[model samples]
Target: MTASALTFDEVRQARVALVGPPNSGKTTLFNTLTGGRQKTANYPGVTVERKSGRLRTPVGRSIELLDLPGSYSLRARSPDEAITRDVVLGRQEWEALPDAMVCVTDATNLGQHLRLFLELRQLGRPLILVLNMMDLAQKRGYQISIEALSRSLGIPVVTTVAMHKNGVQDLLDQIDTLLNQASVTGDGTVTTDAWVEPTPEAIRGYHQEAERLLREAVIEEGVPEQLTRKLDQVLLHPVAGPLILLGILFLMFQAVFSWAEAPMDWIDGGIASLQQWLAAHMQDGLLKSLLVDGIIAGVGGVVIFLPQILILFLFILLLEDFGYMARAAFLMDRLMSAVGLNGRAFIPLLSSFACAIPGIMAARTIAHPLDRLVTILIAPLMTCSARLPVYVLLISAFIPATTVWGGIGLQGLVMFGLYATGIIGALVVAGVLRLTVLRGGRQPLLMELPSYKWPNPANVLLGLLERARIFMRRIGTVILSVLVILWFLSTFPAPPQGATEPDIYYSFAGMIGRGLEPLLAPVGFNWQIAIALVPGLAAREVAVAALGTVYSLSGSEDAVTESLAATLAHDWTLATALALLAWYVFAPQCLATLAAVRRETNSWRWPAFMFIYLMILAYIAAFITYRVALALGGG
Candidate 1:
């Protein structure tokens, strides 16, 4: 048999699965092999993340690499682990049995990692074991007999650093060789049996076998590593650790405001120039109004905040890569336990800070159903990147740009306060829910902390690039369509002849806003603000763009050159601005978030409850903020 004799499916594209435990550096290797050419979404009927990429081998063969979610065992517990177990055993409807598997394991924790490896070998796939972070293992004085490990496991073993480009060539070569073997011989190299659920006795037997193998293959040469211990003395102190976590979070939010200033100015200037050119060149028609006010002003208003978003993502990726995120989760465990939840809930809530969808998806990692439900319910309370534009816009307009506390910017401090408010709100909601609707026994936090290392620059860049693409994609589709529809509403039913007010005052949007004005007015929102809230239900950031489009069209002709921030500051009272900010802090601003909640819970009951509670919270918070501001003579 030869390579030329294989079928097209086997010859052209071979499906390979990358399986490993959490914090095992499996994703790092996937990124190395695929060069960030991966698509990340959810699998059918569940929110477990599906990540896959394509790679071309040296022999002109293409490989489809599936990066399975990190799991501890073949015995399914969480949805993430279930996905891994199902795909490998050919149980999933959408996935084929992988022709080959790359089982990555942390070199420093061979005892626990080998247990998973031994269980996976039962599938009898053409598997290759990758000992990632070999350099880190060597530095820690841990040694392993690679040849003996391979012999014991009856498979090929390779070592990879994963962060560097040259690290994965050996692993790739092994995959190519196994794939080639499958293509030519079509031997019993793949699992063909239906997955049988494991019994306790069988699981215990596998663990024993793993322990036996580890003793033979691994050699512990010295005392345990002291770097993490030395760092944790200060980092994990009861007083200092919490203080340090707060300081780190505060600094991260502050950097979102400070570091993004120059780039934001550049984007603002570019959008302004484009708007001016379009206004002057187009012949003052619907096209001109639509382009200048609807598209440019609407999309540009949100796009300008990309710098701030990227900065936030940069910090998150760096913290995650440097392994401090796990420590942060650990620090929050005690606080979480006090709230009647466990430390496992901390990560999902923390992840919710970036986006509720992922945060809700991340709840799948929690073992207990009640705990997962509570985490999902409170996830939206954490301010996501979408709310950054709303916060930055309101703060820049109302909060002075002056330095406070001897050096910090007042705007940044305000931004940090907004984030803290969200955190406090999430805790309160979780505490309430745990005591009421979802009360249950708390699970213990058991997680292995990865060794700290300098974040790989290439990985950071790729992470940022992926986030940028997501933002741009939203701007081009959902935002674009919403803006166009909003433009129509603000333009049509042509203003009554010789109307004294701006043209928008008589448009459909104005009528709709006025209809809701009485309801929202107590919170300091006028007709325009009310109108903006309608589009905001689609996405939180859209409210900023909606305001831009509404104000751009409503203002006098000279207002075209002014930024939205300046325009808002001139027209809106400080009381109204503060009210809006407070409202957003608890508001259910994204329908996508609600949809995610619905999918995660598999019911409309939870989503409806989520929306009602959040709305009540938003209204109360906004009313209080508005009343307090007025008392302080903010008007």
Candidate 2:
């Protein structure tokens, strides 16, 4: 079978795709081959990520390499699987059929991983089989015959330790060789009709054939995954596992506060210096005020939290790459099932800790519609990184920095409590929705637990860099744009000159905030808090920025130099601060998250219901918290 006739110089760039099952190290190979040359975006309409990169062969020929989503088969059980199938068959409107397919498999578990390769072979496209994690396989005493496997499968096979970039050149050389053969044969046309979804009987036959091939070409001299199994025995323990998981989380939250303090202080000091320099250099005018009070104070307030956000992501990335995330999900299965959720929901919900937008979109993996919807509705309640700024700010202001028993910081305990509250709230909401609105039979979680390995530093660093890039980009674009508009609203209509109150008291923002204050007053929100909440609808973290700008404008120049946390600590009562913290725990403040829900569900009704319910929850939670705090003498 010849490869697709598409030449390297054809139309734009010839494309090659990496196909594999999950945990096959396909993405690691993609990262190794592409280095920093990759770009990630969604496919034309679907939310499944489209990761493509430029790779130059040893012979100096360039091709676009696509890393398709991992799938066990082309059966299209989920949106990710559907995409893999459609793209492979040239079915997507925006994607053309690839000229060649590279099927990656875990070398240590070929018996299980070869089924997907057999399915891909039926497509008759030019194919290369990659035995990734070859080093690990060899260490485990698995002896694979490269030539025998190639001959049996009728394709070239390459060994790769993708994390270490070993034998990657051989894979590239083979790709060049295949493409050259296709060009000579002049049979580059891809044929999609050769492949079809296998029936149950055909699937069984494929499995049997895969096993036979493995028997002929492979020998196992030692117990497979012995170390992984030994570790799993303890890590997957019923009682000890949950306790360990909680301990890890408690430590993570505590680290978020402890590790981030120095860097956050540096950022705060830098922002204060910049504000002071601007106040000294620029004349007293709208321009100076905009640059100093509006832009610096507002944007800096959010940027200072970057260290904490990245610290949180660092932990998540490391856990995910180390393969512990799967175990955590397994540990939570019982609790999730009791709430009418599949254990699979844990991943999307875990992702919510980064951002609810992606979390909601990730629901496409859940096969059940009701299960997916319930996951989406409760995703916002999972304290995202955006809320970290708000939570940390309030905790720093109101919660004491004193140590408690076992050497834990009280501030971190409060932070952990807030996260725990969000989790409990999500469970309660999921249960209620399941029992009422979207009630349905629950689906059991069926997922693979990948072997544990040391996380690749390159991959973890790449992830952290991408996260930082996205965060800074948001501040430059969305946050910066909103702060400008907010500055205009808070600054204009020039204060009825000679009035005793601050200039902001008579501005457009002030009037609007005042108009809403009466309704929010019961929940402990003043006009400034009301003002902040309006722009906060764009993003939860923006509320911190909004408050900084509002308070900066509402007070003397010295306010711009003082930290927002310190300023809030002085002006806001403990009850109001606690209430605001309670409010954010349930507030559906991100419009992007709503838009994601709308896109995912293909309905306005779900998003609307989501918004209304979250708002009511936020207000009620805030009201109760405020009253309780006041009664406890926090007023």
Candidate 3:
């Protein structure tokens, strides 16, 4: 086929940036417009994530919507805020000058939110002021003059309830109008000079402007709303708040174990049925072994815990949407600051519940370098989702399937204990580091407490689906590869004619595990457990699959298709099980997490130190756990 000259159509898509203070519904608005089409990646040469989505106007005009970090001002503090400032000022060489700026502001906090708008107005960009949470504002009997605000700023004003996608269409229409104006004016090129370096005088003037505009446009009937105020009395009470926070987290873990029982049973039954059918129908061969022993046993062992993982994320995402998560951080701020970190470290540490890499990247929000480093160092101890499979596997295998009063399962209690262990460990380590190395003065906690609202079901569903996709993708790729390699290591070098034990006892993995047994014996690890730990360095979740594979090969031929949990319970002592759990709680992080530390810190020194300290802690903790369990007759 002959190539014709490519017809070039001038793309008039506006480079629109959605900027606002944290928890200002900026991301909700972006998600509302983009739906499922948004992509997440890192900014060039920086670890901070860049999120963008394609938004199409009613008339079919497309615009690139950029979701900038939630920053309070153009005057940069944290790395996230710095990126937002540079991008808005057209100073980031990697980004185009925004053709339009969607300044999302909380309608209830206009006095403060409008400060950003006043600053952005100085840049001379086409600005659309988004007054979000209008429904809540109206419910509280506050009146806002959209027309007056628009006239004062000389820009279109769009009001939205981002959670429910209300007023999103209006925002899109305004964006369309701005893009048309920009194309007509031929001012698509960025104007860096328009943004002068902001000084204290300029910031004060902007705040004054914001206050004046709020006076003119906003009528507050019940200032300092009573609902949040009343709730805060109980939720923020120094003693009550921490107790309630702990109770909530404890209940979450309990729910993860109890509510997920039915689904986990279904998954487990399905796997067992499939394994039995394959074992009976297929002739014994490498193919059958790989399918039953490698794929099903390995991947299925990890996949069985999917329901529990979903439950964990469900609680987190819901709390986040309800705006209670910020409160949890606020409640923990005193404890965090005592360890030489500030309240800003709480969010990143909280993010670690999902993954440490993002949690480490999130440390960019901490202004102090030492505080940020301390947060990154301890982020791995926050019981990330990767550790969920291991926790679920051990708890299921060892803990009894019984419930305490109030219907809390014993298995869930153990799961909660594991998570709590990690949290307490992180705090303890952070405290020690602060005293010895990263000592610094306390930084003031400057944070916005968003008004509480019901979490949108659609958003919750989408968040859960996204988390499931990420987990499943890892299982299919990383877990599958690791399982295959492990299967090979356990299957090679056929047993001698008169072998007395399972063939795996003579395989490469078995020999290596035996070699490490002496070193790990004090912690109650066996040859099989030692072998699993090797591949676990790639991903913590892989340890569960590795155990499944190792035990599958170690079992007698007649029991090849037995459940991994059943096999574990039958072969492992209670002390060993608990020690293994303790080991995982403090184990050196996976290679990916270590690599992230290296990249974030710009050196091998931190990652090396992290591995050493974590390993030492893991060993000591495991040794202690093993000894105590033995004394308690768990052995």
**Number of the top candidate by TM-score?**
2
Tell me the RMSD of model 1 versus the true structure: 3.6
Give each model's clash number: 0, 2, 0
Sort order, TM-score high to low: 2, 1, 3
Q: What is the lDDT of residue 406 in candidate 1?
A: 100
Q: Which stretches of candidate 2 lie over 4 Å from their true place?
A: 1-12, 188-190, 193-195, 219-222, 354-369, 388-416, 544-577, 595-605, 627-635
User: Each candidate: what lDDT?
Assistant: 0.82, 0.84, 0.81
Measured against the true structure, the TM-scores of the candidates, in listed sequence, are: 0.88, 0.89, 0.84
Best by lDDT: 2
What global local distance difference test value does model 3 have? 0.81
lDDT of 3 by residue, 553-629 (tens): 44322233347778889999999999999999999748768878987888899999999999999999999999999
- Which digits, one per residue and each the tens of the lDDT, describe model 1 over residues 261-291? 8997888788888887877788988989889
Instruction: Give the local distance difference test score of model 2.
Output: 0.84
| Inter-residue clash pairs, candidate 3 | none
- Candidate 2's displacement at residue 39, Å, is 1.4
Off by over 4 Å in 1: 1-10, 139-143, 184-194, 219-223, 341-369, 384-419, 541-578, 595-605, 626-635
User: Candidate 2, 321: how far from true, in Å?
Assistant: 1.7
lDDT of 3 at 488: 84
